[model samples]
Target: MKTYLAHGTRFEDTALCRFLNDYGHADLDALHASAREEPTRFWAEVEDAVGLTWHRRYHTVCDLSHGPEWPRWFVGGELDLFENLVGRRARATPEQPALIWEGDDGDLRRFSWRELDDAARRLTTALARLGVCPGERIAMYLPMVPETAVVFLAAARLGAIVLPLFSGYGADAVASRLIDSEAMVMVCADGYLRRGKRVDMLGEARSAAAAAPALAHLLVVPRLGTPWAPQASGQWREWDYRSLVAACDPDTGPTIHGTATPLMILYTSGTTGRPKGVVHTHAGFPLKAAQDLLMAFDLNPGDRLAWITDMGWMMGPWLVFGGLLRGATLVFFEGTPDHPTPDRIWQLVGRHRLTHLGLSPTLARLLMAAGDAGLPQPGQLDSLRVFGSTGEPWNDAPWHWLFESVGQGRCPIINYSGGTEIGGGILGCFPGLAQKPCGFAGPIPGMQADVVDAEGTSLLDQDGDEVGELVLRAPWPGMAHGFWRDAARYLDTYWSRFPGLWVHGDWARVDADGHWFIQGRSDDTLKIAGKRVGPAEYESALVAHPLVAEAVAIGVPHPVKGEVATCFVTLADPAAADSADWHAHETALIAHVAGLLGKPLAPARVHRVSALPRTRNGKILRRLVRAVWLGADPGDLGSLENPSALDALRDYRDSLEAVV
Candidate 1:
């Protein structure tokens, strides 16, 4: 029998139910169909339902005359994201909790709606005093502090685009983005506490600011009471964060702009080449994020939503906009989840009473490896209503463990899959549907997505067993305004492959039960002999064994089979894997994989490692693995959290090459 964390009765009382009731939709399927069939009407209703207050309403929902590649949404509309996120909400409920932040050293801080609005107003005034004009770019290189949120919204209030850099980025990675966007100002912190250690960020900001000639101002927030000595550069000026706030008055006035005006320029990790600035407009990203949160995650007023993310990643901005737009309280944690103790996250849930919590599958596996002994008591997690996931594809083992252990089989795992450019979820599990362990309910509303053949001539719906490239037939509001200053690259990357369709690089298929499963990135597919297989399939089979913590499968050169599979895995116990009897365990694991996937698809070799190389956001760098194995130049190491793990992988690769 299939296990269900939430039943139909549980979903009937959700925020999605209330929204559908007001709109007179019978169920989620009807709402999804309505959104796909008549997107304009659906979006118009959504604007009103979500209480979007615009200076001037849009004439049309979207203009797709130029095709999906160049979609213009909310045409002729003018509004301020700050007004929607802070101004209106503050005016209505000044004392309501807007943001709750917890520091690494066990310090807690909170901001009510009015308090956050005042912070944004003061910051905006200070920015304007610094000659920050509309359409300029301001870079933010800071920790997940409350001030970070203020800086983001203040930049929007001034009609300036904010470029959020990852907190972990070094000088080169930081300077590349600042130079690319021609950022005028940078807001940074002196340092931040992580894992009981202080990490200095001001030095990196200074180095980046020195290289970025466009930078004219450096605003430093002193988190550790450290004095900053700015380089005596004639081209730029330095100011203290507290001093600026104290010297300026709150600017409570509204700043409006055209609907398509750029609000943010978030740079991709430069996985393929130079980092492309993915531009997002006010109405574009905010509306799509709000809609996805409402319909997919069942967000609403009074709900507390928390996700483990950084401002540099899309989820950071997504949650910031989605939570406030939906009138839900947002929770921001400034440290690692399992820093001081394995129960830290659980304690936060019990303390803040977060109803919706989101994390990546890698994070969940890490916690699972830590074991459930330190977890909260059963009733301690009573406030949690939904468990959300994103980043990468989930294996059945970790997904089941998270569902059973964390949720107690009473909360739904709302699996969301999308990209930085999409703004929100492309495929998501709705609260109104019965969810599988690792399957999405369907594509999000208003997203006309399907699994189509390579040529895009026909849909691959062969009894739900056909796997093909995922593509979107129609344009949605959340789609990026194209890569900044690189329209040709944007078209070539997404639109050129399938004519008019937006070719998402993921290989996906819809099962007979209407559940969608993303196999992996199409570019990362492996060919063994004559059969093609996704890395996820092989990894999933390996992770089914109790000894394996995580696994990554790659196609290595084979003498006779043309190409064969090899898996690098992290065991549950590294010491045990290093013992003399390790060969027996490895043979047992290989046999287990062969039993699951057959000998033809079984990995020819399996190696044990202490850890896998992953990005800060928990995404495995598969390309980097292949590159290290083949001794090729790995494109970018900016997003890597543990670069040292690559050294261990290289040693393993050298051993394999010895046999070859």
Candidate 2:
């Protein structure tokens, strides 16, 4: 009953039961032991063992001037990210295939390490000739083609920060980021195919560049047919990436990038308004990225893997760097998952024999909706050894189903959680730990996590297990350098909340057995008749019912009664079809919560929708829902993966007749 284990060795079967095993209890103890004695040295050894490149050796490992609040990592280092990812790979094995991209149209392409290096060189030289200088910014508004990745590294080679905007992002989103970074140039495609529809990226970029004063040129790569009317964008210029590379030099000059300098600005959904720019640096970016791939995924050279995401998101770089740094083959699909069929990803997994599978819970839920229609048989993904998930809490059903069905119950589903700023996961379970379903075994080896109370006190429940706001007692290499051009804002946002502690804003609590659980965000906490309630606690209660497929609960204002638990739930097929049964099921669910915890818990206000308005990474936009309930304007729908979902929910809101 495991995902797919060879020779009849099930996932539940331990080393004692299975003839073959990748890692077991002993390996976990060894990893923990190493971290206990000088964690910095332990991480450094891992970095060296995994063959990480460095331009100049570091003088100090870490400097915690204000404790873990404002710590400096990899102090006194200098190296361009491209050197670590591409340069050494090309030098050692030029012909080794670094990427294997498969578009939704079934077109496939492979780029060797040498070819990638040469292409990057040509692009770098062409950019240099155009007066592109160090410390400048170049925005990449391109599709998921190999050229997009090349453009990113090319910018990095010259110490220029590259900003990636999702091709689907509107003009406003583009203008905000472009103005923020003051990008001098933008790389984009004339048009691209998604589910076989033509999208005019050039047209969108053209309109946006008009608002951005700093943007000097529009560099278009004609991806589709011959040019229509020329885009009246900035500079009115275009470049054939391949042709420019052919004419340009194969070798560019050496770089002089500081390790702590800004490498990229990734945006996260802000509850208050527009997305916040989460900045990361050159040194911290690659160190833990490789470490995460090595130990957490146990990735080896030449492995093939893919995750579905827009390039504008953080995982775009994470997938690219983590896969390539370990010499693993990268795969990308530029269309909707359900375009040709629900089985698209499974088909790719089978076709490429992808060694690692990265997914989001929302994607899993969509696949679950397809039921038997979407999934292939268990052994179809026999090559998959590791599965990673991020963006939100992993529900038990989807986690168990994904583990048991596609993976065939053998591979480890690495439940990873970290922000874009961390470059990689602060909390991830390695294969060495017991691969329990829907559980994060523990924190990443070097990351020291703390679950503390509101007053900066470490809290443990009655069972003597930690359950509180998650904080870091010590700084790790992957922590964000700071917010871009806003250090005071960064301190106030993350550190000042609890004073001198890296309060991550998430409600993390551990069980008596030391298993960790993230109970949604602390900012998402609600007050129900004086008792503080977390959405995770309430949502978990609702999801335990057989009828529910997905659940989202937010506190709604009640004039005399303060706030009541008004939950919106999507039901499973048969139960949802029967109105009487649905109401009965809702009644039972509320009673179940009341019995479990001493409260009325409120009956569910079930609303059936095609989908929830989630982010690209699958995190539910609860703030958006709350804004709608209060009749306030839902600020910035830019991060929404499906903006149409909000329109569908208006009828449901009208049915409620909620008054702000």
Give the top-scoring candidate (lDDT): 1
lDDT of 2 by residue, 100-174 (tens): 777768888888899888888888888888778877888888777887778878877877777888777778888
lDDT for 320 (candidate 2): 77
Alpha-carbon RMSD, each predicted model: 1.7, 4.0
Best by TM-score: 1
What lDDT is obtained when candidate 1 is compared to the true structure?
0.85
Which regions of candidate 1 are displaced past 4 Å? 1-9, 457-460, 658-660
Q: Relative to the unseen true structure, what is the C-alpha lDDT of residue 39 in candidate 2, on a scale of 0 to 100?
A: 73
